[model samples]
Target: MTFPEKVDYVIVGAGIHGLSTAWHFAVKLKARGKCDGSKIVVIDKDSIAAGASGIACGVVRNNYYQPAMRELMTLCVDVWESDAKNLHYHNVGYMQISPKCMEEDVAEIFAQQ
Candidate 1:
């Protein structure tokens, strides 16, 4: 189809991040009666999910060396949990199998969270 001359939102990619952001925006706009599919446009050089997100194995984990990363991951997990069915997410939980040497470090990270 030919592209429209104007759009309310123009998403640059169709990868996980872009798609999720677009979905959230569309949801909010619809609630405000400000948008429908016609008002939003997602432009991607490749097919949806054909970028790094598609090649990378899907693994949701809260493990991170930085507190900020952990917090962000926690928030992401919450979003996934909120719409597990719609998002096709399996909240079966994650396991971090570590060697005895890293047990203390892992424990410390867990404690911080």
Candidate 2:
């Protein structure tokens, strides 16, 4: 088989995790002016997002019951909101209903961190 002449990143699996990682790598490479000549090859036994991501309910929640978890979720929210402009992400709004326990847990986590 003919292979690419050069590659900057070789990603295996095209599920949500792999694709997301590749997206970030592309962003970083572009920001550093390395994307022009860089090659990012993602290989998977199946098509992109065809595994768990395809079957996933597409539900995003902050129910991890940890402050750090909530903080991380918040970071995800920020990125998702702004990703449309910077990364060409086209998606609807994010929605999450926090239970009282999760809220308390997140509060404590934030306080501790």
Candidate 3:
């Protein structure tokens, strides 16, 4: 594999989080006038965003039952919609589908987060 002469950061995973982190790092470097696609490289054992990000349904929502997760998920959604626009992102509008009953067990999901 060919590598860069110099690299600023190396993220292992090509999942959404890794890609987002790399994007933000590049954005910050650009904002500081330190970079414009310079010396920043993201390498995945596989293809970029070919893991979870590719298989995901790309749903954005804040209606989660947990507070912390809800906030993080909300931030993820915002970045996907707003920040992605600079790179030409089209928002298809996220939909949150709830179960027929609101009394289902959602505590585990929140707890894991």
Candidate 4:
């Protein structure tokens, strides 16, 4: 593979955050009549999602207590559910076992869900 001698943008990682940032930035720049994404380059020591994003330990749930967080989670859930194939989103059910002190908050979260 060959890379250009000079590029407008250089992204260090190909992980989720890096790709998302580069994509959104490029979109905004193009919308404003700025540079196209051709000059942008994404480089990673390893392959894409070679970091924590490649791990399977993370969990996304709508179990937050705050209103804003809950709303954000709702949007995230929608996005995840919408693209199950490419995103590899597993809809495995979640189970939460908390102590007595968290019973109220847990119940509230359940109600919200």
Candidate 5:
């Protein structure tokens, strides 16, 4: 296949993060009446979620020490909850084991969560 000589966007990978970035970026561009999403190209080595995202233990966690990261994870959980049934989500709860040095950080994360 012939690749575009020039495009508005050329995103790498097609995993969750990559796809989400492309979607949000294209939306912003169109919102400003800059150009159509046709200029956007997403090239993956295998396929969508064909990387690590495709084969995980399915253990989704939002436990984060940083507030910003926690918020982002919360948004992810929200998306998962939005389509719980079809997604077959299970709120099995969360647990973590860290060294004593990280005890304080873990406590902060728990409180925020």
Candidate 6:
């Protein structure tokens, strides 16, 4: 396909991050009645899912040590849950076994949420 000479947004890769960004951008544009294919462009030297993101095993979890990270991961989990059926995501949940020393820290983090 021939790409447009001018694009409002140029995404460099077709990995998970780039694809997610493009999808969200398209959704936003559609909501504003401005979703035209020419507005955003995604270019990758290789085919989609041919990079690091694809090679790594896909594991979704929310057991983060930092509060901010936990919050961000929660948001990501929500997004995945929102489209579970279409995305083929299984909400099997996650578990983390902390050592005796870290148990208190883990509990504190959970309490903050």
Q: Is candidate 1 or candidate 4 better by TM-score?
A: 4
1-113 per-residue lDDT for model 4 (tens digits): 59789998899998888998889888998998988887788999999999987885767877878989989988988988899789888888688999999999999888877
Give lDDT: candidate 6, residue 86.
95
The TM-score values for the models, in the order shown, are 0.71, 0.61, 0.60, 0.74, 0.75, 0.73
Worst 10 residues of 5 by lDDT: 57-66
TM-score of 4: 0.74
Residue pairs with backbone overlap in model 4: none
Candidate 3 global CA lDDT score: 0.70
Q: State the lDDT of candidate 5 residue by residue for 35-108, as single tens digits.
A: 77878989999999999889888877888777998888888889889999999898898678889999998888
Query: The CA-based lDDT of model 6 is what?
Result: 0.83
Summarize candidate 6's per-residue lDDT along 47-111 as a digit string, tens digits.
Answer: 89889988976777666778888889888889888999998889786576878999988788777
**How far is 24's C-alpha from truth in model 2 (Å)?**
1.2
Q: Each model's C-alpha lDDT?
A: 0.86, 0.72, 0.70, 0.87, 0.87, 0.83
Ordering by TM-score: 5, 4, 6, 1, 2, 3
Which model is ahead, 3 or 4, in terms of lDDT?
A: 4
Q: Which candidate, 1 or 3, would have the higher lDDT against the true structure?
A: 1
Question: Which runs of model 4 end up more than 4 angstroms from their true locations?
Answer: 57-59, 84-93
Model 2: lDDT of residue 98: 71
In every candidate, how many clashes are there?
A: 0, 0, 0, 0, 0, 0
**Deviating ranges (above 4 Å) for candidate 3:** 76-113
Better by TM-score, candidate 6 or 1: 6
> For model 3, what is the alpha-carbon lDDT of residue 29?
85
